[model samples]
Target: MKNLFPILLMLIIMVNASAHGGKNHEHANIFENLQGNNKAAILMVHFGTTHDDTRALTIDALNKKAQAEFPGVELREAYTARIVIKRLGERGIIKQKPQDVLAQLKKEGYTHILIQPSIIIDGVEMESLQKDVVEVQSQFKEIRIGDPLLYSPEDYEKLIDVLTKNIDSETAYIWVGHGTYDSNTAQYAMLDYMLKARGHTNCFVGTIEGYPSFDDMHQQLKASRLKKVVLVPLMFVAGEHAKNDIAEDWKNDLEKEGYSVEVKMEGLGQNPEVQDLYISHLKFKSAHRKIGIIEKKAIYEVTGEKME
Candidate 1:
């Protein structure tokens, strides 16, 4: 009976260990099953540009960086600008829209999708992208859109650090963006405010078609009394606006105001730090299925309670 007692105790211990370990093993198996079923891909959406030089420097470089950051995951690009896609098609360069690319992804049996847009602000383009994704949301198992470059306050602060790395006290810097007429244009003004608040007093921000107009920026420049001014494009690509509007129009106007102006023909995408920022956002979204309510609240606060 004594020997039987020892054997029975050993059997109980073995049974307990198996029970506990088997439960954990079963959970691990479930997690692996879910991961295995998810066939994921990233869709990089850019406003796109016809200028090959800027395209190569900005869009192409960003795409290559993203691919390197997430190896073995298929990556594709789409252009949000209909006109840019059409123009590229005319030249034997075919660029698809977000919806078209989404369809292709679905056809390829991709169940999960992460869409990252190379957009400066969450404005009209972002709204349009959201709608396009909504139309085909049922086609995919899951889809998440990463935030724009300047969505959160942290994003703005990080961008400022990237942009003001080479600030010169003697020169005034102006960041020109393609602003929209909607209230979203206020983001540019917010960036301008943040710049000065962070001791970038020599820097100013202006838009082509929105608030803080060229005159507004020029007035600030005149007040600053800085003789030299540098124009930087606050855009994904230094395309037509940076080349012509800023290089010619803003530069000439500043020159007329007795300020020696120089335009930096570089886009936001060309900055390595900016590319990494986008990748970080993608990584974050990949880990978290949806953005937090705090982020949504921030967007609403910036857009005057407008969710879209």
Candidate 2:
């Protein structure tokens, strides 16, 4: 009876740790080893949006989760979208440019630093961030930039699992993403392929400005024989793209094509699992500041999962 008491106590402790974030403290300790001689800090950069409501649910939630993960780290933020920054400034909400924020961090004497972007793809924003990193390179002792989401095959696996966590296997999910002309836009196609590759045949991906346009999506669905489809934005905020583009424009198009279209007016950032992926990216960078590249199985949370 007394031995059973200790076993029950151990089980309770394991449950609490797993629920809160398994190995969270271990990851935090490893991140601490990334710090150099000087004070350490993080700059979480993102493409700022104008809609404050979705901004709260998506961007705000993501940042807050990052803060929770690094409870003691000095954290800051910057916005890549100058138009949105200017608009917010006009509304009396002040935000800084990514380069300007990087410069200020340098001035503040934070030697060991990490710039973690919340960007989903490796595109224009990443190039922009690289330029900023170069401009500020001489000022800091060690300044590392975390890779954007979807940099590896394991990333796609994690993404598919998280994005489809609440989705029905029977229904088709048409993910609408903001597109780019750069080579990295192939990610959208790979995402679609991963869905089909993993037996999630009901999932499809299309972009606002990339390959597999609306026509492609229509054709894909036309063959599927599924009458009802849900449009979910593969974006950060459920803002203009999700609301007007996916829900309205795509919705109208699909309905006209003789299909029942449903809009799941939520963005990728709204997913707790997705936000954790971003947080894990930051942690992975911190853990591997000396390595400069990711080791596939070590950092990504979904390395060995058997998919549905």
Candidate 3:
């Protein structure tokens, strides 16, 4: 028994170390390696929404929250979607692109930049954002990009908690996300599995264009024997996709199949907890001041070439 004490202690220490290493690695000093007179600013990038109502509730609300939390830290926003920007332009509302924003920031003499995207997952949009940042990376002293909402395992658990806080266990719940053709679409499936694993068996996830399609979720709903369903938008804003795809189309299809449907009409960004998660991600990146780039795995998958 005496000989086993040290071995048991060692095993416990190793387990604790592994867990801390994976999740809390960003706890290091954010200003440790930073140098010079740092004129720091934050750039919040969104996919750009055309609807003013949902934009105020989601995107504008989030931006206000960020500005409040970061008090006196100059903050700006950029839209990734050109079509949205163009449409808004026709209305005489100007929205800048990411590259243009970065250029303007540089011209204003900002030395450091921390970019946080309001994206649900690391899909093609994230890849494109990284490429844009990389192009003008030389303009700034240091630039760091934060991870998306569902980047790490901890992120998945956090999101599950946020989404399922007021969940109705008796009625089936389906989260509809704008799924991508890229491999990142797997995140949606993983979210569905994690929801079930965490005891929310009634919860389901499906993408508009990716795997775990509407049919897949419909089949699951049939097997579960639940007649009532709640459709929630997994996207940041309850814009065209949520209003049209989930609210109108999905609801119609499910009702036709003899199931009672209730549309939430709320985007993920509307949730205070969800907004805080994005802020936390920005704080993490701000402290580290590391270069923001696409993950090596994503780069290889997209271009078929490994990043060193």
For all predicted structures, in order, the TM-scores are 0.84, 0.82, 0.85
Q: Give the Å error, residue 217, model 1.
A: 0.9
Among these predicted structures, which one has the highest TM-score?
Answer: 3
- Taking the tens digit of each residue's C-alpha lDDT, what string does model 3 give over 111-216? 8788899999989999999999999988887778888998988999999998888777799999999998878889999999999999988999999999889998
Best by lDDT: 3
Which digits, one per residue and each the tens of the lDDT, describe model 1 over residues 146-241?
889998888999999999997899999999999989899999999999999999999999999998899988888888988998999999999989
Cα shift from native, residue 118, model 2 (Å): 0.9
Ranking by lDDT: 3, 1, 2
lDDT-wise, the better of 2 and 3 is: 3
Candidate 3's C-alpha runs over 4 A off are 1-37, 289-308
Q: How accurate locally is residue 59 in candidate 1, as Cα lDDT from 0 to 100?
A: 92
Overall lDDT per candidate, in order of appearance:
0.84, 0.79, 0.85
lDDT at position 169, candidate 2:
71
Q: Kindly provide the TM-score of model 2 when superposed on the true structure, using C-alpha atoms.
A: 0.82
